[model samples]
Target: MELDFPKRKIIHVDMDAFYASVEQYDNPDLKGKPIAVGGGSKRGVVSAASYEARKFGVRSAMAGYIAKKNCPDLIFVRPRFDRYKEVSNQVRDIFFEYTDLVEPLSLDEAYLDVTQNKKGNPSATLIAKEIRKKILDKTGLTASAGISINKFIAKVASDYNKPNGQKTVNPEEVIPFLEALDIRKFYGVGKVTAEKMYKLGIFTGLDLKKKPLEFLDQHFGKSGSYYYHVVRGIHTSEVKPHRIPKSVGAERTFSENLSSEVFMLEKLDSIAGELERRLQKSKIAGKTITLKIKYSDFTLQTRSKTIPYFISNKELILETAKELLYQSELQDSVRLLGISLANLNTEKKKAAEKESVSVQLKIEF
Candidate 1:
């Protein structure tokens, strides 16, 4: 039967201490202990830390040295990106078994739209629990899930009961849930932004919801309108499926601006290497190559060339980037360099079409 109204069932699933937990799962000795995953050097930052470490104020992106100081016995493990990606693929495959409306935010987090799930389950909470169970069974990992009518509240609820937990916020409970939420707990408010909101006496969602949209826009610019809606549990973003990428690219900002063409070419070579790695991983070919440059003054420019045949060879991509770089004049010091490949092939397009078809069937039937 045709559904009379639009029913959106969004679930946000986030792995607890994704990197660190993975390490612990692989090594039984590390379980139940404080652990972190990242570079161990002085310049290193924590990529992820166990909840035990978090109790001591350790967090991702914090300086490794500071993390160590906060938790002296913290075990440091190096990041294994390839392994993480493999597990991510495994998890995503599980999601696809339920619904094709899966949007991956990163290697360890995603939003799943399961309004018309394969199992014909009407309760989103049950679907979330089953997904978590399957992830644990398949990967030996713990994940927290949140279920709600929309993306914003779902994501927030996921964080509420973390590390092998799940929470659901029904439509009737949305307003009360948001009203008591701290302003900093709102997604877009970073440290500086939270401090700014605090200065304005905005401590809770209720406070933010009470503010005029025009006043917020005057104070926070374009994002002010965003905050206004979020406080009221309103979110309209759709889950974007992972498809064959339209472009493979890499960009890097320099520590210090360089005036020499030779230095700029060196940076371009590095970006080309990254793009080549991604292209090889995707097993995709492209016919068009583009080179981008940013001047010290922040002005940006790009030059592109399209070949007759698609190629995935790293040497070809690098050569094209070098040629583009040479074709452009060096008028100012270079602050950034980027290389990209576009105009992908039919294989990815076909796969994306199949996925869309499945999503449509789930939502309609």
Candidate 2:
């Protein structure tokens, strides 16, 4: 087999404790304190935790009670999404100064392809350094960067340094670096996948690399081919300047669970209206509607319907969502209901369908 990977240089930039840092920077009283951004109530979850709070093992997505238990001094602040979006725009503007091939994963992280940047700079590392500097200078917040020949290696390299630092994995160094990496650290291998790999005696990148393609394909399905090539430093996913979104979704978590289907239907209507508004506002329409239900006991179920054409109006979205909902009996008293539109008229479905050869790697750190 011939491996002719692209020689393009890529960089992954990530903000450090973005939400918490924003809170701390804007509030003088929060400086030098262990703070988290999100809910303080038991039913809520932490959106982000400051480095001070992280020292005691606090982290994002942890339940509020667990975060508080980990760090008794943890100060929880409500999320300010509007302010964060403002700063994100500033960071993205700085990135555009270097490259147009920018793919934003979220407000705090993105992948940039600087193979032929606006500045014509040859070194991706230097661009990363300058970008980080500009983010701090403009936004008064720190950012970390990883540099490499492709997104997979670049994303992993970015986390090697933390809190306003950067690391670059040269093309020559990618193989050795991946060889030394644990399988658990691979781009898409999650907890369950790692456990499955461990049971198969595939504990490291080298072990994974040694397995045959057929074996991997049989074990992991479509992602098998992706894992096979990535381990050998062969990643072809392009740095799309326009990363079409996968879905437009709206969800609500109720303070009180609803048992009656009539009441649930009302909540779904509200969610569907919000979803329609967001979709229209984004100037996007989709062919598929998904209904997500989360029960009081934390279990979840989802139903989806893909229609023939795109629709963004509230009535159509509500009708489809309601139909999907009634297809199955309510499993339990519901606490959360969400409506989302997918199968959008974009490269999203195309990218997902042909994921074997050109799969964009997502950052998980």
Candidate 3:
């Protein structure tokens, strides 16, 4: 059965090294130099790395000490989240000018459905270029864009030209594009999945497409079906304007391994406070509270409970975390502690329909 649906015009806009760029833009001395937004301390992790730092193999989520080793002159700047948020809002405002169907993946990137845009612009390629230009004019920062018929291809295409560029995968090009794409280049296929695909002889989209639906399903379970359809240029995910988060969480890694539950209370308290602040900021609550523990050896464990009523206050969150902590004994010295709330009080959006794959003439919306 062929998958088919309305050929919507989707654009994925991703800011280039957003946090690092923001730091450079605000401080002239930092521009064109190797800089990381965070990871100055012993336990620090790099939040973002400038292109200069990336040349030396420094990357976000890498250890600070390693980043420093990679780029000896790498300057570590403390993150100014408030300033970044301000700039992110400015960029998002530009998106709102084009379409109301905007789905923010993070502060750095978003997916836009301009099938029926406010400007009545029919060419998604042109709209993507305009958006990137406006973002640069407004914020003095560059962004990359991917334009295509669906979110999956758009998202993958957006990464094709990094730093500052755009790529478009038109309806006619979608299939051949996917077939030639490296399996690692598929948006949702991560490092582990890519390795697994390699072992399965699925080195490219063509290899993935060659597998029967039953073979994929038998090997990859539910995700196998998704792979089968997406390779055929069928991804029906709609651009959600109000993307509700599945969970709100906060976590902390200690400089030293904490041996006792008593020693962890303070850290857990701080994490709960942060989680509460985030929940309050979003003006949402959840019935499920989860406590995550990472041992010194790096093994992780989680404990969760579902209360009848939703709670977003620190007192309640901390209370539940403590209870969960006491429910089980320590397997090893703790390295990180976290608290999260799920089962949020938000209505879920419905998925798009997949109908006939009859080749209808492409209509520019």
Per residue, candidate 1 scores C-alpha lDDT tens digits across 1-365 of 22121247899999888888889998999998999898655556799988888999989977788899989999899999999999999999999999989999899999999988898888789899999999999999989999887788899999999879999987667778899999878888888888999999899999998999998999899999999887876676667786456788889867688888787766777777788888888787889998888776667798999999998777888888888878857879887788888898734433333111111223321
Count of clashing residue pairs in every prediction? 0, 0, 0
Best by TM-score: 2
Determine the C-alpha RMSD for candidate 3 after optimal superposition of all C-alphas: 3.0
Worst 10 residues of 2 by lDDT: 356-365
Q: How far is 98's C-alpha from truth in model 1 (Å)?
A: 1.3
Which segments of model 3 are wrong by more than 4 Å?
Answer: 1-3, 273-288, 295-332, 347-365
- Candidate 2 regions exceeding 4 Å error are 329-331, 348-365
Q: How well does model 1 score by local distance difference test?
A: 0.83
Model 3, C-alpha of 232: deviation from truth (Å):
2.0
Residue-by-residue lDDT tens digits, candidate 2, 28-108: 899989999988776788999999999999988777888999898999999999999999999999999998889999999
